[model samples]
Structure formats: C-alpha cells, structure tokens
Target: MKISTETRMGRNRRNPREERSSFLILCEGPTEKGYFTGMRSRRGPQLDVDIPKGDHISAVREAVSRVSAEYDAVWCVLDTELDKMLTASMLRAAQGSSVELGLSTPSFEFWLILHHAKYTKPFQSADDAKKMLKKISPFWSEGNTRFSDFADKVDSAYARAQQISPDGKNPMLNPSTSVWRLVASIQGRPEAIGRSTGAGRS
Candidate 1:
C-alpha cells in the first residue's frame, strides 16, 4: 500500500487523548520566534510561538512559570552561547518541568545554516555562524523571508544534524544543535525528537 504524503510526513496523527494537544514555544530571539512561526503556518494550528521579553534564562523561567494543561508541550528555543552560567541555570530551572530546551551551539544561526549545507566546523561565536551564512547567501541579514525560503528543507537539515551526534548527547559541543529534534517534534515526528537537557558546554 502506498502511503500518502501526510502519513509519510507524520501529520495529523495524534492520539485521541492528544487530539487537542498544542505547543507553546518560547524563543530567545526574534529570529527564533519567526522561524518557528513560519513553520507553524505551514504545519498547522497546534503551535503558538512567542518571544518573551528578557534574557535567555529569564525567558526560560517565564516559560516554566506559564506551563499549564492548556499546552501539551512547552519548548524554549535558545542559543547555547548566550551565557554559560545562564544556560546552566536555565537547564537547572527546567529540570522535572515540562519545559524542553532546543539549543543551538555557538548560535541558532547554525541551525539555519544547516538548511543550506552540512556544517561541522565549530564557531567561536554567533557572529561567526552569521558570517558563514552571509557567504552562502549575500542577503543573509534580510530576515524572516530568508528563513521561510529554507523552511521546507528542515528534514534535510535534521538528517544532517543526526550525522553529527549519533549518541544524541552533548549538543553544546561547538558545531552542534538540538534544534533539529524540536523541529522534528513540531513536524509531528515525535519519535525523532529529544529534549535538550544535560547538554553542557564543551
């Protein structure tokens, strides 16, 4: 039997109890928020992505405080380079809670960069990732329109991400990101997803 694209893509396959399941994504930056929002528009009506007004840790704390039954999943999309101490605190704060962390090492731009190519080199800073991205696309700083252009390539990016970390551990080790796992979850492939806790600085 041939499977439909929706079935192969894992869309609209939630269980009866999870029929009303929805997601709440707390983004650390506007770009992250816009990225998730673009995916939401293409995916369906089960997501609400927001960019809280604060630093990464504070925003994570804010997300933790707002977790309720209304949301079946709460995710915080953060860059691991924000601050070592703050990232540590954010991980601790999310422990035992429903808040899942989707971390990109060096920066979230690394995840975006993955859409264009497979990158394994470590970045010293988020700026480094941005610089490399600019080399691939001259108008890299254009904004959400740029992100939407590559949103459909998320699965390719996710596949490339898997090649970097086979054990699914320590994603903060420079050129790595757990963002693909979160993207998988958002795409309705929950089995391909993994939480971003215990991913420490390397």
Candidate 2:
C-alpha cells in the first residue's frame, strides 16, 4: 500500500506533553486516589497517583516500594469521613519507605466533598473542589489552600449540619479534597505553607 504526505504528516504528530509528563505514587484510600488520579489525567497528564488496594500490610508495603522510583513526591490522602481519626493517617504516610510525605483529610465529616448519600452525584474535579473549599472557609484565602483549614471547615460544617452519614466504608469525601496539596508540591497556584483552608466545595 502507498502512503500519502498527509498520512505521513498525521502520523508525525507527537504527543510531546504526554511524553514529558511524570507519574506519582500515593497510598491513601481508593476514592481519594481515584479523584486525584482522575483529575491528573485531565490537567496534569504527566502525573499519576497509585491507589493501594485493601488494608493488608503487603499492599501498603508494595505501595511504598514503588514510591522510590515511580513518583516525584509521596502523599497520604484519605477519607476521615468516619469517626474521629487522628493516627491511622500518620501510620499510612510513615510506610512511605522514607520518601517525603504530605497528608490531608476532611473535618469530622470524614472526606472533603459535599456528597454523602450517594457518593457519586455532584462530584467535581479535584482542582474545582479545592477552589470551593477556599471560598467557604475564612481560615483560607481562596488562592491559599491548607489541610488544616479543611479539617476545621469540615468539623465546623458538620457541627452546623447536625447530621452524620451512615457510610462506614468510605468515610472521607475522597482525596479530590487534597489535590491542592499535591499540586502545591510541584506545579501549582501560589499558596501559604500551613494555615486553615476554606470551606471547600459547595
């Protein structure tokens, strides 16, 4: 078969941006990883987040094992959307095999998103959610994002709502809430080091 110049030119088109992008390894929960990973596929194709399966020791270790080579920085994203959780997160991030780490969670609300009843509807991208939180929380200054503000806003918002979700499995609102933290470490909007964040997402 003969090929024309147009066909050759079409084939010549290069996805340089895709070729240049890098991937990242993170072990939080599935939802958070899914949200962040999903967002990256859209905005930062160069980056990817690995989600660890199950809570088994081996799985966690496996995630850590890959961190050394697959990713640029280590992150611990979770849905603390259940009962008061303060330590489980620290433990997961510690297994980072000595890689540097960043962690985030919603307030007593568990996760950072607004949907709880269905866990699917009203789902927004990670970047969009981060911007939402900044708008809601005063501890945050819109452009400036922080996990602490996330916790506070979550906690305070939960108090005002006067209701608790029965979802025992994925307590947190998914890691989309922490995208800003992930972005800040590399390519991101200018932000403060560590302050309370905004209310996050509508």
Tell me how many residue pairs clash in candidate 2. 19
Worst 10 residues of 1 by lDDT: 193-202
lDDT for model 1, on a 0 to 1 scale? 0.73
lDDT for model 2 comes to 0.41
- Residue 20, candidate 1: alpha-carbon lDDT: 46
Q: Pick the candidate with the highest TM-score.
A: 1
Rate residue 79 of model 1 by lDDT: 80
State each model's CA lDDT, in order: 0.73, 0.41
lDDT of 1 at 160: 85
lDDT of 2 by residue, 1-202 (tens): 9999999998999876645545465555544444444444454546556656764244445545666644444444443332234435434545425443333334312234432221232323444444554454335342333344344343343332223322122224433134333444444335423422321211
Q: How much is 185 displaced in model 2, in angstroms? A: 3.4
Estimated TM-score for each candidate: 0.80, 0.40
Query: On a 0 to 100 scale, what is the lDDT of residue 167 in model 1?
Result: 45
Q: What's the distance in Å from true for residue 189, model 2?
A: 2.9
Off by over 4 Å in 1: 1-20, 42-45, 145-147, 193-202
